[model samples]
Target chain A: MGSLQRLGRWTLGVLERLGRGHLFLLRTLLAMGTLVRRPGLLLREIYSVGVLSLLIVAVSGLFVGMVLGYQGYITLVDFGAAEALGTVVALSLVRELGPVVTALLFAGRAGSALTAEIGLMKTTEQLSSMEMMAVDPYKRVIAPRFLAGVISMPLLAAIFSAVGVAGGYFIGVGVLGVDSGAYWSQMQASVDFHEDIMNGVIKSMVFGVVAAWIAVFEGYDATPTSEGVSRATTRTVVHTALAILALDFILTGLMFGDI
Target chain B: MTTRRIEITVGIFVALGLAALFMLAVQVSNLGEYRGGDGYEVHAYFNNIGGLKVRAPVTMAGVRVGRVTAITYDAERYQARVSFTISARYDQLPTDTQASIYTAGLLGEQYIALEPGGEDEVLRDGDVILFTQSALVLEELIGRVLVNLTGN
Candidate 1:
């Protein structure tokens, strides 16, 4: 009977947290309505979140693509299908790897930072002081960061895919002696703009919304203490990574499945 | 950072992202090719299509001129009907053009090859080619060879 009571209490606690999270989301979204009037704040946040993370995203994308190209060439050469290396690389990057990897990297880079920043603000009573000064912290702080994250995601994903494709070309044609013309021509013949590229963009956008929402929510919901801030930051990263992966599977099925 | 510096940096980032997308669309995919409309379609019937897929190239004399648009069964005629669109630039094909399915290399994809005949009348929209050759079936050829060998 004691164990049953504990289980019941745990479920209710979870439900209560879920309800508060949803309310926080609603309030943040409403606060975002005034965003057009203060584009400067959003721009600053974009610089911190998106532009600052560009180097890591591009470098990682390059290595990933080069590895794919080298591996693909070796396997395909055995089958005398080396001409298909470009098609294989481009399709995989544009359809699956580009958006998914970018989202994971973004969560690690920007999502955790956003959570930590907001959590620190709370721990220091900055948010409470802003409220005392008749300032709505949601509009002033949370909304800009949230909007910045949401807007930066798709752009970063596009850059990653493009750089990755270049990296693949470098390894496939430059290092492996694959015919340059065949490399690009085959990829052009196979990859469809509307089907693959647009779907990837849509996927990144969805991941951005989810990652930003979770980060901001965890920070706002964190207990006002240093330990609480650290916990919230850790949760933000773990939850965002898991959510991006799970959502990628569901999005891929919906986008690609004939059924 | 100063507001001016942040604004410029963000602007450059956005520009870079857009340029990357442009490269993906134009260089990495066939976005430049006019896929549909602005072209006339012709029909042909085949006994066997054999791995032919939609969007497969439709070539004339080894040069691509169009794309396969649809493949369906003509139950009334007991044949496979294929419809393809020829770019407006290649609208002067003879009405008696011969259409045959050909595979690229031994294991490559299947595509339609059209050979223009000596007819003065050019093929028009909705026109059907009278001479249609079916795709070669390797298994059937092997079966025929086996039958000949055993019989001999």
Candidate 2:
């Protein structure tokens, strides 16, 4: 019985610490200075986060569009609103699907890599060595990562939305035999500059920032061991995914309500 | 460095992507450059314009000659006020144009179609379109059709 209570206490402490860890990261960011001194690092990190991962995002986006189109077309046909298939695809993809799916893909691809890399660096005392050498690790590491994420996330989302919308068209018109001219026209009419693309672009940049920050924070704090790195990597993906989804919901509410 | 190559590649991708988007955008326009400025404007008032989105095309004799331009519902008047842009080239409608809510098909979107009344007077941009049709929802239409067919 004593052992059970002790075990429960220990579990509670660990959970409490885990909950508090994000606040520690937030504090670290608030204390972070010298972001301006690290232009080169920022540019490089942006490439890694934004550019290297395009192929994966694009492929996923294309398939999502096709599937969304397939679903919307059949559903609209049942109600005789078959002409509305294009608008439905465009509205849903740009407003909701694009930012989310792309962020999830980023979590799988980049978030895990960031966590593992940071965890390994922590274990090796390499970050300490950099600190001892008077190198500002935040400037060299975190700033660039944050900047890169901000840059790349929107581009990735745009690619996702466009591919998805086009996929809808190909599947909806070519495969489903809807008139291509009418399909395109409805899509054009349904979307406006404010409601669709602009909102998506803004949401994506926010997701990028949150996802990268969580991944890096988890990794930077991990202990110096293989197990630590593995755990950090898994946590990075999970946390990033959750943050992206949560942020998506909040931003969608704010953006649409204003518009 | 390898990073430079990545940036250049990404730049190209972004440029190409934007170009593709621009091309698609151009293709999606009304391109109805065929401005037949001979049609008269029509107005409608509805107690409720539920699901009656703007830009829904107005059809006559199974042909689309104009599109809905705007929708404004006056709460005080207890009416949904809508305006449609007709080509000026079509025959001028009399002041007593009868407009009604229409469906594209069984499950189609709701539109406001105008049936010309022989009032010997034509409808202009601000004319109060007489005898308007409100939208016919699919479920309601279906229920009616089914009930009639059942011979009940």
Candidate of highest lDDT: 1
Residue B39 error, candidate 2, Å: 17
User: Which docking category, incorrect, acceptable, medium or high, applies to candidate 1?
Assistant: high
lDDT per residue (tens digit) for residues B1-152 in model 1: 78899999999999998998899999998787775555889999999999999889999999888889999999999999999999888988998999999999899999999999999999999999999999999999999999999999
Candidate 2 local lDDT, A1-259, one digit each (tens): 9999999999998887677666655654654455565355656666677667888988898899999889998898887778788889888887889889988999898878878877888898888998999976666666567556666777788778888888988999889998887788777766655456667767887887788778777888776899989988888888888888888888888888763
Model 1 residue A181 distance off true place after TM-score fit, in angstroms = 0.2
For model 2 chain B, where is the 10-residue window of minimal lDDT?
A: B26-35
Candidate 1 per-residue C-alpha lDDT over A1-259 given as tens digits, one digit per residue, 9 for 90 to 100:
9999999999999999989988998999999977899898899999999999899999988998999999999999998999999998899999889888998899899999999999999989999999999999999999999999999899998999999999999999999999999999899888888988899999999998998999998998898888999999999999999999999999999999862
lDDT of 2 at B48: 63
What are the per-residue Cα lDDT tens digits for candidate 2 across B56-109? 877666566677878996888888898887877665667776777776565457
lDDT of 1 at B58: 95
Predicted complex 2: CAPRI docking category: incorrect
